[model samples]
Target: MNYKRLLFCLFTGFTVATSPAFAFQELQPSDDYIQVSKEIVEILEGTHYNKPSINDQISELAFEDYLDALDPTKSFFLQNDINALSVYKKRFDDAIKSGDTQVAYTIYNLYLKRVEERLTDLENNLSAMLEGFDYTLDESLDLDSEHYTWAKNKQEQDETWRKRLKNRALTLKLNGETPEAISEVLTSRFKNQLKRIHQTDAVDVYQIFVNSITAALDPHSSYFAPRASETFNINMSLSLEGIGAVLQMEDDYTKVVRLIPGGPASAKGELSPNDKIVGVAQEGKEMINVVGMRLDDVVDMIRGERGTTVTLEIIPSKGTGQTSKRIKIVREKVKLEDQSAKKEIVEVTRGDDTYKVGVIELPTFYSDFAAQQAGDKNYKSSTKDTKKLIEELRKEGIVALILDLRNNGGGSLQEANSLTGLFIPSGPTVQIQDQNGRITPLGDRDPKIAYSGPLAVLTNRMSASASEIVAGALQDYGRALILGGQTFGKGTVQALQEVDKGQLKITQAKFYRVSGETTQHKGVVPDIIFPSVFDTEKVGESSLDRPLPWDKIHETRYPIYWDMPSLFPILEPRHQARMAKDPDFIALNDQIAEFRENEDKYKTLSLNENTRIQINEETEKRELDRENARRAALGLEAIESVDDIEPTDKLVYSKEAAEILLDFIAINQLAEREKAQQEQAN
Candidate 1:
């Protein structure tokens, strides 16, 4: 994660290198780096959950990871360059263990040389290349790097780059830029990229090399340089500042990975995971193109004092980067009250009976650690607030309850256990298995049930970590019906250790459900799946690289509250029928399908100007058509294209969950009445 965008809260918040060979001084590993490298190896091998060995296999994987990190698009290095670097391919393990970073440094220095060469080539021929493109030609460019191999030679690389440059022009032209503006933007970006490359320091190179080795073992483990370590500490302590987003460098773009629950972006609900930020502007300033910019530099530009606004030119996660939208967020402290549990009452009428359904939206499982340690009895915590909210909901005459954990990317494990206890009797809520293969069950020791009425838990692909623990626990105990999309599978525990100069966040343990199923790669699956806009392939823990594998251990002892399976038959059919015909749901499904089709088509983009124009127009038309269709179905007035669409306050998923909870209540009522009749007859 980029330190600049590390936290929407107070704290949260990548780079490159090279050489006198390209009029830039090459970075050499300092004495600190050598000692730190050895320390990292010792810690990872001695205490990491996987107990990874520093062997040839790990070295080979690190080599690939390092290369990909440097040039993910494979545009900078040639096949021959890679061939030359292969000698160090299997030497990284020994290098790290022996405190020798020459292998990593050599590879990075060469990569920097290639970057300088490519940018220089672009700079030298920009005018001729810009004038030379024939948009009428039926050519296409493959954007997926995995589909490409290293260019055989400079000519092959030039041809690939020529098409790329043309595509860049075409993209900007389609976005309404003039020929002069496009030329200026392209020239400035190329120059800026080269300038930033020259600015790369030893810390940048060291962080990349160490991370490559750590990430080779598992996606969750990583090394943070001194600067990044400071940002990480701030994130753990502060909850106010910036826009509350975690950003990473993907190719040339800074991508939003996660939006902090209480941050402005999450609250605003416009910025989403996987959205690529292409440009940024301060309030009342011109938008600065950020393509090929360093992650920290971009962050520096985006961060501001509280109450100030920063606008981002975002290529939406759902779009194929051809179209973009701007979002403006006010920088502010992410207050605990803002993230606190909130309750709502939804009234659902079936035939004649009106049922009041309680809805609690928990953004994150948070606790005030400072206050708690200070013996503050009323210290802010998710469980305590939720318990109070439930009491308030019960007072409002609600008969059923729904806990909405949508987009809750887990927080404190203690909160997860205590929160789960609010609905079930004392029992193990989650199990942790460490490197020693010993299982430790962490559960709610309290015997009190906060709200035991007909219950349903709503989750989505972004519901992760602590969220998964709570959802999985309730589901295993048959205490609630899990609804919505599959939860984010992030059940691994990470602990930060201070190395010689920086910090290392390493995976230390794994989380399992009371049912013995590990929630690492395969998050908690909902009992009633809902139509989701999130693409499984693009979101969730399973989508990450080298995620810990899913396995099971012995099940923990816990009493079931209900025979949930028996009720699924009645609920599943009703849900399917309702969602299939529901106007909002139908529209959602159509939009997702359209987005997916665009994704497939965007794998390789047409170079023909007319074809691209036609495609963009058709996409907008389809989007407008779907919007009008949905409006007409709901008997609302329809307006013009794209511009006419407005954000609605309606909670579509929550409404559906209310309907499901109503059905659950009805089922239980019928069972009770039948039992009474039988008893009377007997």
Candidate 2:
């Protein structure tokens, strides 16, 4: 049941020794790292599906990716530094082949020098400007500088830092912070950032360089340092006693990328993917701002013994302005019991006839393979738990079902196959194409139908891997109505290889649906698409560089239980009409539109306090109006303002999904009746 095709959980650790400021020195790569680099190159060249050559072209790509990894925003490094390092752009492959990392080390040393220069400038400039900084200047700071040109000189870099600091101060000012408090926070954040940069050891730089090379091959392939590999194992096993959240460094912010089901954070349901963690506080302690802090250091701050409370200052992924909130969560082990399949029945009334639909919300396609292998009869698995839940729901007289796969990032490939088997007569479910041009068809050998009633699979952008397999299979067989947004297009298979004290996750295969379409870049498209706040331009596999392109092979024949294509014309108009009148869906679409507008407008922030405040007020008003409208539609009291609204953990999309399922049930039943009558006439 190994779901090797899913996203690989990997991380790397580094030494964090205290160092004196401005103590710039050369960092030498360990002999082991050099050897591992060679091994990694050999393995990737031999085993990777892309079969990329380590020529000047790849060397150039690796060099650019490496630079981007080091300074994504192009904030620290100057144009001179980039020009100086351009000589090594075509020499990385040569350096790798010779097992001599002098070029990489030299480039990293230069980056360190730039960082030291910037830190010194920030300390001096901010300390002098804090006394009489102008807050009413008509200026704007471009937050997204990914494509911005590097600073031409030290003077230009200083101006960049000035604007950045001004924006920081303006944000705090807008949040009702005093000038003195804002100054203190900015100083501390800058100092901590300097310390983190100083703590970057040789191993950290080596890992980044190696990852850059692998990333140039394919986005999925990566190199994990020894400590990172250990962390990866802990995350995969979900055995770590912490908040049960996966964190990554996005610019200087530690972003929450995934929330493990049954974990403290997931149970709270307030924290979401893409939310930035700015501060972390232990119980009864002052909050420490984590902005510009090392990601591993932030993780250490958040992880502690079970039952101990950790408070996080989170900047939500949605909305506009510098809005933030504090969430207190008690750390605990993520229980598998919480992740197991859960069932509920949504009662839908149409014309005085109530249709009860069973909803099986799957958090992950999990399987306790270790327990099963150890002969534990009660080994929990997604397919097994779902089958039991279906049986229970059947006994309750449920007429239809919704397999909720929203936010399910997939696990256990065998479970996906078996889960698909529950609805369709057994056949090939997914096809895997390896580096050697061999296609292997994996299927459910058993022909048992677990549930044959009207079915719909609900998914979102976060739904991926094994979830995609099940959804795609059902869609291919016309067995279930696919609902929600396009899934996370992660169709590549990775195999973990142990090297000298490290691990390399190389993309070795690609997954294709039974109908021959690969889900690499374009994920499974639902029959009825929903409006999502997730920006696909920034979120999916297609958004990433060097991703494998979508293609198709010969289709694996499978029986079509329901002709969804023929039914789409009859069903889509009805579904659209219902959504047009659905208050929740209408609110969702409005929210999405507002979110997109805010995102577009806030890419660059105005430094003028009046303009910034005006923008913030407008955003707040819009959000408040949207919330009140939704409340009114749901038969709840409307709030006066956004501040009056209480935060709740309810997922709005999930409720909308239940309504869609109701429509699906009605349409399916009517279609069945029509088919029967036509058969009688025939």
Q: Write the per-residue lDDT of candidate 2 for residues 1-682, one digit (tens) a residue.
A: 1121111111111112343445766677678766777887799889999887787988999999999888877888888778767867898888777677767877787678778877777777776766656877798888775547789997887787788788777777777788888878887887887788878888888888888788788888888888778878787778889999989887778988878877899888778888999999999986788987877789889989999999998888875545577889999988888899999987777787877878899999888988999999999999999999999999999878889998898888999999999998779999999998899999998888889988889988888899999999999999988988899999999999999868888999999999999988899999988777778887778877888999999999888887777767766777677768877767777877777766767677788888877877888888788888878888998888775765431244455556666666667788789999999999
Per residue, candidate 1 scores C-alpha lDDT tens digits across 1-682 of 2222222112210122222346766667778777888889999999899998989999999999999888888889999778767767888999889887766766776688789888987998999999999999999998775688899999999999999899989988887899999899899888888999899998898899888899798998999899888777777765448898888888878999888878888878789898999888998986778987888888778777889999998988776655678889999877887889999998888888788899999999999998999999999999999999999999999988999998899888989999999999888999999999989999888999898898999999999999999999999999999999998899899998998898999999999999999988889999999878788877888888899999999999999989998999999999989989888888888887777767767778888999988877887898789889989999999978786776442378888999988888889999999999999999
lDDT of 2 at 327: 89
Model 2: per-residue Cα lDDT at residue 521:
88
Global CA lDDT computed for model 2:
0.82
Q: After superposition, how far is residue 190 of candidate 1 from its true place, in Å?
A: 1.1
Candidate 1 off by > 4 Å: 1-21, 644-650
lDDT: worst 10-residue window of model 1: 5-14
Candidate 2 clashing pairs, residues 3+ apart or interchain: 11-228
Candidate 1's clash total is 12
